[model samples]
Target: MAVKIKLMRLGKIREPFYRIVVADARTRRNGKAIETIGKYNPMQEPSLVEVDSERAQYWLGVGAQPTEPVQRLLELTGDWQRFKGLPAPEDALKQAEPKPDKKALFEAALAAASSEPVVEATTPKKKGGKKADKAEKSDKAEKPEAAEKAEGGEA
Candidate 1:
């Protein structure tokens, strides 16, 4: 009964999640497992891998062979290195920092906006766009016509 450690596919199509488990080598990819060790989610930004080191070491000691992909996952978790008596890779153990909450970010932006001085425009803006321009032109035209009528009366 050749024992093996491998991944069991889960989650929806095109969005894969996996369970790291120990099972018979001849069984199906997602068949019943003797023991579930951890989970893996590759869809995340940094990818998520969790494994029980104690269980992994014990299984490896008892002659459980890990599949290729499962071996990479175990390496990420440092289980494979520890099982093989090798030094764990430093970068593999580092986790990404948690993102700050949106509320705090919003409040910080509001604070920044409030601290800045507001400058008023020197010239007043016209309320009516083309209508105001047309009214000014009509007033000038009327003023010219009235002057011509006065000059003609004087003559």
Candidate 2:
């Protein structure tokens, strides 16, 4: 029987979490599994991946083929690298603790948004020679004269 390492879907609609498991290749997705080895939570910032390294390596050694997403998760959790006899990644898993407080981050973002005036970005005008400059000057000259006439009419 061909064994496959794959993700078993869980969680509510529109919010997905997954369990990494080893099962018969012909088994339906989200079906019964031989063993659950880990979990993946993509809803978290940067995503959360946890795996049982020993179990993962043992299954890989015994010829369980990993599905693409499972393989990617293993790569992330450093299990895939260890399975391939590679060195542990430097500071990757270690640095995974919440780097900053989430509430503080949210408040700072909100404050920044509220404190600033929204300005639309204008595309730069293409540079042309004298004709362009003359046209620009004519436009500039028209605006203030129009403003002056309005002011005079008000007076």
Candidate 3:
């Protein structure tokens, strides 16, 4: 059976978690996984990723393919590097090059900021007026005397 390393989406809406698994390529996205190799939580600061490098390398050697995103995660964790061998000298040389002039960059940013038009930070007048109207209507709808009586009775 053809196997793949991929992510299975979990958690609630707006908050997502993923499990890295080795599964039959034909299985549904979140269906029966053959083995859970790791997990990733993107909600945390810096994100959290845990992978089993030895198992991952073994699977890759055995011809299990990793999906693109999972491949990136593996690369970030350096597991892929170890499996594929170190990067070429050309890549290392490119990274070793000196950074551009910071003073020039700062001056350019200052010029851009000065050229940009300043705008008030307040909400747009139309939306602000409508929101205020809604708040006033809601406040009028609620009986303060009734609220006071409820609080007084509770006390």
Candidate 4:
């Protein structure tokens, strides 16, 4: 069975307490959990999030996926980072700050476009539509005069 690390609801109506657990993906929201790894209490001021980093990292490393809100909780504990082996938050900020030059980006895009063969559009254009209509009317007017002359000559 596909496994997911998600929440199990435990508290009374409108007063919610969640157990962050590793459970089968097919199970109901508060069903039998394979293992409880953490707890989340949003009712408290500043919120309370307690997660076992080692257990969380282990479950994530072994392919147990966390649900959206659970993923955010794992991020709070840095369990997600530890599982992925990313350098700590401070180092990540330093690496992320340097923006690429716009000129370099534009030149790279231009080079790629130049490498590809250009394609001409094959759809017919409507630029000459009015002129074509006028030409058709002129041709029809000339045809009737030519037909009259031919009939007069036959008479």
The models' CA-based lDDT, in order, is 0.92, 0.90, 0.85, 0.85
Residue 144 in model 2: lDDT = 100
Clash pairs for candidate 1: none
Which of the predicted structures, 1 or 3, would earn the higher TM-score when compared with the native?
Answer: 1
User: Residue by residue across 50-71, what tens digits does model 3's lDDT show?
Assistant: 8887899999889999999998
Among all windows of 10 consecutive residues in model 1, the one with the lowest summed lDDT is 88-97
Best by lDDT: 1
Report lDDT (Cα) of residue 34, candidate 1: 99
Model 3 residue 63 lDDT score: 90
Ranked candidates (lDDT, high to low): 1, 2, 3, 4
Estimate the overall C-alpha local distance difference test score of candidate 1: 0.92
Sorted on TM-score, best first, the list reads 1, 2, 4, 3
Best by TM-score: 1
Residue 3, candidate 3: alpha-carbon lDDT: 96
Model 4: weakest 10-residue lDDT segment is 88-97
Clashes of 2: 0
Q: Write the per-residue lDDT of candidate 2 for residues 1-155, one digit (tens) a residue.
A: 99999999999999999999999999999999999999888888767788898999999999999999998888778888888889977647433564788899999999999999997669776688899999999999999999999999999
Question: How far does residue 122 in candidate 1 sit from its true spot (Å)?
Answer: 13
Backbone-clash count (model 3):
0
Stretches off by above 4 angstroms in model 4 are 90-155
TM-score computed on alpha carbons, candidate 2:
0.59
